[model samples]
Target: MSSAMDIPKGRASYKKKDGILTLTDDRTFLIWSPMPANGPPTVSLALDKILNLKQTPDTSPKVILKIIEKPKNPDEQEGQSFMFQFTSPTDARTEANALRDLLSQLLAEIRGGDPNVPKPLGAAGGPSAAGGPPPNAKPPSNRWYDDDSLKADTQLQQSLLDKDLELAKTHAQALALKSDSISDESFNKQFWSSRVGLLRAHAFEQHQKKGSYNVLSTVKPRAENGEFKLSLSPEQIQSILHQHPLVRRIYNENVPKLSEPEFWSRFFLSKLAKQLRGERITDVDNSDPLFDRYLGADNSLGVASKITAAQHVPHIIDLEGNEENQGGFKSGNRKDAEMRPRANIPIIKTLNSLSEKIMADVAPADLEPSGTPESGAKSFDDARVFNQLSLQDLHGEREAGSIRLNVKDQTKFFSNHGDGISGEDAQIYAQQNPEDVLFEVVADLDTFDDDGAGGIDLRKSIGVDDDSESDHYEDATMSGIQKTPHVGSRAARRAAEQQILEGLRKARAEHAGGPTGANAVEASPMGIPPDLTERCYLTQMTTTEFLKQFWSAFLSSSSSGDSSEGGSAAAAAAAAAGELAYHVESLKRCVERIEAIAAEAERDRLRAAEARKKQIQEHYQKTGKKLKWVPPKGGRDSVMALFEHTTAAIEKAVALYRGSRG
Candidate 1:
């Protein structure tokens, strides 16, 4: 039995050739007569190409194998078939049956069926001689729907159509559609108008099915009535626990003793919460007695020790261990300020914990587990380290010489005869009079005043006015009373000092009845009343808070859409739509608040202005002297200015939502 097979030529014809049959490792059947030359087998056929196998019912049982022949050209109408017969009265039938089973199994596998079970012989789905059902036929459908279920399905589709119609009507109204007639053109116009909302709604529905990472910053507590309220999703809860193991520990310990809601309420107000949130903790900050006890649970030093224990620093790069020998001195253990334990130990611990969590989450799966002996050994391989430490030979290296200039004519290369100017003209320009340059420098220097003592007088150099110069001179003369030699003429200095003293006395007498100088209250910028300013600030903050919530929902609903088909996807879409609507309403209310605040501030300003004017007139009539009145600066204009950007932002959001619906 030969194991090797020869590559057969196109459609070989056999005429009762005596040969030994054998199957090769690659599933090729071989048949060849042993020749004196000892060449390759003459007949070879692949298992995959065999279409059918059967045995002839004769005294000498012959196995007939039908196989498809490869076409020489792709455009050939049909492939040819070849039949091979193997005779052996005793075992031909058994071999034919086995071969048929193998071919059937291979066919099943090619059609993506169970290869272990051989398929039945004959064409699939062909009618039997009795015209009965095909072999292995599936049972008839047992599923049946009642009228009520059918009605429900019909109603659902009708309701969806009604919703589309309602959306169309809403969009038409927004577009200011004047016609009531439902013509084809009008219907198309309405549909196109409503298409944007339909797309947005579809997108919103799709987004709800996707999984999103929890944003810790968005999980904030709001003050409702006198107590703080917080809402946390299951994912957010898991995220918090994963980020802060201390919080997880506290919750595990205290949950059975305290109700969940009460525990969360206390946690939000605790010093531990403030530390976790990275807020500065002061003595006056609100604290929970029970929760505050766990404030010191996260030790920075302990975390550092854990981190150090989990790291495997190779001896070759161990900075801490080799610090003593770094500078040829016995250096004591020292760390940089950032590397040292921080004053806020809990905060530092939280930071380290978060960093470790992030690294673990993002690290590749292929990396070996940290702090393991095997991992360390693989990480710092001796051969790799040796290769890295080996230095390249520099002694045998040749230094590159400077580039050589191959100028055909050195005289031409040195000449400045190209472009605009000739060599003679350039020389003449360079050699021009040095006196003119000196004259220009002298003219520029003349702007500065040379004080006989090597330094220029800065006041004169900077062009100080006459009044400022006299004031500076007066100050210098006043200082001259202490025997300063900078000021000239003692008599002149004394006269200036006496004049200044007289002017000061007159100013003090004129403003004796009222507060003056530093004591006088400065008017508010833009004449805006303090109360109105505070109200504006509050309104702005409220608007900002609303905007944050609005965008969060908006973004969450605007992300990737769900392509899944089910009741779950439909439910998710409905929930997302409701959330988006709630946030949009919030933004609209914030805009309204802004307008109301602005109007109220305006009314108050008008009333205050009238009262102030009445008082001023009465005082003027009684004293016969017009008192200087600085009217309150900012009124409605200032209030509006404060909220202009926020109002515009809200308006833009409202318009966007409106446009989307339209």
Candidate 2:
């Protein structure tokens, strides 16, 4: 495998000789095409599954795949990736390379399966691969439909086992964390302003180290009905604002401005954060030394990091968080006896050196507990490799080009973990910047005239059902992206240019029409690199595109933050985004409640209309009964109720929103 492609163009192009689609990363995907009537993807075949997996073991390699059976049959399949963090750019590259190597090896193992023979495991009670029933199994359904919510939810939910629910819950927790940094924080104005320089530096490190850490938190409003408390301090406010995707976009806008070290390094303790949280940028094998340094495992796409904290740090977090034995990683914070631990030294040094002057600062009192108990690194630690799963696995939205994940519940995980930024701002930031992102791939290729004019069905060795109306049995597979010509042909080149210009024009027109999200695509002088420009995106481009865009914005944010990583810049705002999200979610609930009432009103209106029509018809049907004018009734109260319900909810939510704005 060359540069192992994590997400290849979710499309396939085949060469006649091989009859297989060869990707740049050497991942040759074989479509069983005309998916056998019984093989619908996503199944495990263990000894116990013999009775369940009716398809006799095939000679072809068992492609260990996870097929997301979407609500629609046309949705494509998606894969998962694990991620890890690094302190430096080099480490990021190294981590990515390591994952690449693992993936290659894993794929190779998958391809080693026997192709012609079918192994028969003993048990027998499943459907056959050829659309027949096993010993005594029920027939497969040929149609899908939805008549009612309860009926639909019940049947569909049956397909999801307890195991699936467990997986879903795990993902939900990650989403919660991705939204908010932490819940509670007095993160007042004085401290927030004072930390700006330091915070900017941290932002740089955060992006450079971890492209994007899907974090979440939940914040309870001080008031029962409002979205936010009226008394949130400026620090808290700033924190929430920073997390806004729009605000973050602004913060990182025109990142070329931060290529200078002097401007970013203005803070006295800027380098301190760099040292404590990372390794030197140099010594990385494949990535730029400076930018590649301080990588947080999953973000680095094979960049090497000179740091080896993982080699020395020893921890023992159990499958479930417990104190029995620490998990298995060693380095840095878990110091291999080389670095000093500040446990006994006290944090006064850090507190005093917070600002530019390093003047006197009050030390936190040890008398009464601040009740802000801090957990050691070992508390939430997991295997670094296990952490390599893509941000979706860590957060949600299991594909590229998907809508950025929203921060619905913020107070689940990131609450008062680091610098305190207000909860309200955290909620706001999350709403503005969505984690569910989108993207479109373009492949660099050449086009040529079809050698033969009559090539309607130049079919492959792959199965093609002649009886079926659809040429491709599966509508949702990675077969949708059509091939395009390369740069050589004049006509092809002209067409590509025209398309590009058209897209730009449309984008500009849209921008003029309305406000786009802060991170919305923009025109830039330094366009995508011409050498590695994409020809077109994969069929499953949405989710992949989202990942790419989010990462780009994230990287830009990192580049824009100042050298000091301890301040209020992005950190505070990120916190605030979390808080604001809570407000939005609450507002959404209010909307839902109003919508429910409106629905009831609509039903009642229909019922009343039916009754009135029946009475009118009855009067006409009678011998002497006659009706002249029929008065409109009940509509006033029902409509009024709907309005009142909606307005009241909006009012509460808007007030909460305004509170966060201040």
Top candidate (lDDT): 1
User: In order, what lDDT does every prediction score?
Assistant: 0.54, 0.33
lDDT of 2 at 265: 26
In terms of lDDT, model 2 sits at 0.33
Q: Show model 1 residue runs off by greater than 4 Å.
A: 1-311, 315-317, 320-369, 372-375, 378-525, 561-564, 628-630
lDDT of 2 by residue, 24-138 (tens): 2233221211112121111111111011111112242221222121122235343222111222223333433343344455454432231212435531445556665453232
Steric collisions counted per model:
7, 150
- Backbone clashes, candidate 1: 7
Question: Which 10 successive residues of model 2 have the least lDDT summed?
Answer: 47-56
Error of 2 at 244 (Å): 76
lDDT by residue for model 1 over 1-662, one digit each (tens)?
Answer: 21242322121224554444444433434343222213234444545344444444546534565656445367864456656565554665565555555555555443332222355565255866678766445334321223223223333333444666644343333223222333434333323332334444443443353322323556778988986779876557655655566776777577658976787777877788777776668999786788788776752321222223333444565555575466422234544546565567655546655665544433221222333233445354434545557676734677888898887878877565555787899798789789998998889787789887987886666554545335544566677755434333445556789999987764443233123343322223234455555555555655665566566656666562355357777777776677567657767766676677668767877887888888889999999878777665455665566566788898888787676567
Model 1, position 289: C-alpha lDDT score: 81
**Predicted structure 1: lDDT:** 0.54
